[model samples]
Target: MTRTPQCPGCGREDRLQAVPAVYLGGRDTVRVRVRNPDDHHDRTVDRPVTTALSEALAPVPEPPSRAIGCLGVLALLVAVGTFAAGAGAGHWLDDVPVVEGGGVFDENGIFHAPGQELPTAGPAWPDFAWLAVISALALTAAVLVLVLRIRSRRAFTRLTSGRAQAERLWSRAWYCHRCGTVHFRDAPGEDTRPLTFQEFRERVWQEGGYGDLAATQRALGGVLSIRPGQ
Candidate 1:
């Protein structure tokens, strides 16, 4: 009941396979990966989900959140200020005595006023050092938060092109050549369909969005590696 195609390279039906891949996020393109078990040749091709394909195809874009970025920067500044204040306190404490009762000082070391009792000795080191350590930890956490916030903002604000969107919509697939040129099939038992690179240059110019295919390609390229291939 099912008809299968043979591999063009080896003329064998068992050596060819077609796999179908789909992306459900935004785009509606199907990608077919064609493979030949004999020679190990592999190729991936994209096709529109619908018969009428647009030149400028893209997914919905998410808006940027400036508020989050501002908040992150504010947090970072506050952390730095806290650390600086702690450091200043430590420096100021350096001049004060750390004896049991906290002694007083004059130009020549310990001061003994006329009939004044000397203060009790205090701890050897000032407690300001603890403040500095805590502040340093807070600053480190703030820096980490700031970095994450900036990365998230860039992700939301970055532009995605039509071509890249189209690629996202493509389905994963496999294929093998039959007699003439290469043909694609969803599975070994399914009927074969002709697969070829669909150029959107003329259609892009006529439809609306991009002026040419090159423009579409450029627009699809992203500044970050996380986005789809351009």
Candidate 2:
């Protein structure tokens, strides 16, 4: 059994494979490749050299789920619309009269006799208009609640999937052998400007954040060296 050492990059003890040497500028360098298929973490690091070739420790970034967010908003709006329409229909139906048993029932289903307190009341009957309105509103509200819950859950699932994919792709760090500078592929702190290896070296050592290339290399394990001049 060939025992591969723990990965220096992500620290996975298993499933580490030694990849073919990559010759850049005629320098043959060995790399160990390790990947977590579940999280989509795929990266290759130098065999044993230190000096932090890349910012591998930084957390992976997630992607924006604009479409999922929009769908959730749309579902909420539809639920509100359904509730409003049910209420409006009920209000309209409440003003109409009904005829039954050779007698006319008013909106409240009460028969009023004249010359008795101006409005007389007899044995009260059930009111069907308000009942119909209430029933419609209640049924519509229930269905709206169910639909909103389902759609919201679906949207959340999709958003989480998108974030996972983004993290996998952007989290791994990259090393520029020519410039000897290490930077994260998609880290938020990355610079947007186009810079050569020399420019990157100058910015890191002389500008700010991290200064003194020699000191940095010594501190990080002394795997890289600055060019002869600047």
Candidate 3:
């Protein structure tokens, strides 16, 4: 039979508990009085343990959402509509005759010769075509942004999965209540020095493939950084 590892601080193996079990056993319930005088019943609130031990053993936070929102889709749609409208307008305007000089039509529909006044309107096809090009560019940009956001979201999901696996590895750790430290049975080396809660958690993250994710997050400006309790 394999012998359990001894605690580094106390040189004993008796007062040990699994990290998950410790967290579960640390929970407490409290009664909260209602504010309204008419409501005499007190409400019971179940609160998780917030002690240093519990904090060290807490599960990894959920990944941040990076998917494009509804507003973004709406803007993309608007750009497409604008592009279509501009293209159609430009096509129709291309066939229209340009007004070169001021003229008037007689009551019998006969064209009158140019007067002293000059034509105020210029050809509109160029402006409409320019509008179409601008809207097309905007639509392209919106699509690129949406794709990037989706990729970012997928990366975050992978990171979250890695953290969860790390948490599972952490569950195998044993906390020594007597020495206020934690140790892993299968950890390498026989030095047996007790690790603080922070040290243990950090070790778990680093060794469980979570370090790579964290480095990537830092490189990407921390967009995948863990959020507060939510």
User: What TM-score would each prediction reach against the true structure?
Assistant: 0.29, 0.23, 0.43
Positional deviation of residue 196's Cα in model 1 after best superposition, in angstroms: 34
lDDT of 3 by residue, 41-149 (tens): 5655554334445545554532555345554576588788877788687663444444346777655666756643333356555767767776777777688878777
Top lDDT hit: 3
**What tens-digit string does per-residue lDDT give for candidate 1 at 1-230?**
87555554445675344322111222467899888788899978887562211212222222455676666567667767766776675553444433344445644587654445544455333666666666667667677777877787665444323434333322222333232222433433423443322222223222332333333343222112122111
Evaluate model 2: give its lDDT. 0.40
Off by over 4 Å in 3: 1-4, 28-31, 36-49, 59-157, 188-192, 211-230
RMSD of each: 15.7, 17.6, 11.6
Each prediction's whole-model lDDT (CA)? 0.43, 0.40, 0.61
> Total clashes, candidate 3?
0
lDDT of 2 by residue, 1-230 (tens): 94544433343434332111111222335798889678889888877342222322111111233565555556556655654655565443343333335454356867645322322243122332454455556556556666666776675455444344333433333433333333333445656333333343433333332333324333221134433111
Q: Give the TM-score of candidate 3.
A: 0.43
lDDT of 3 at 149: 74
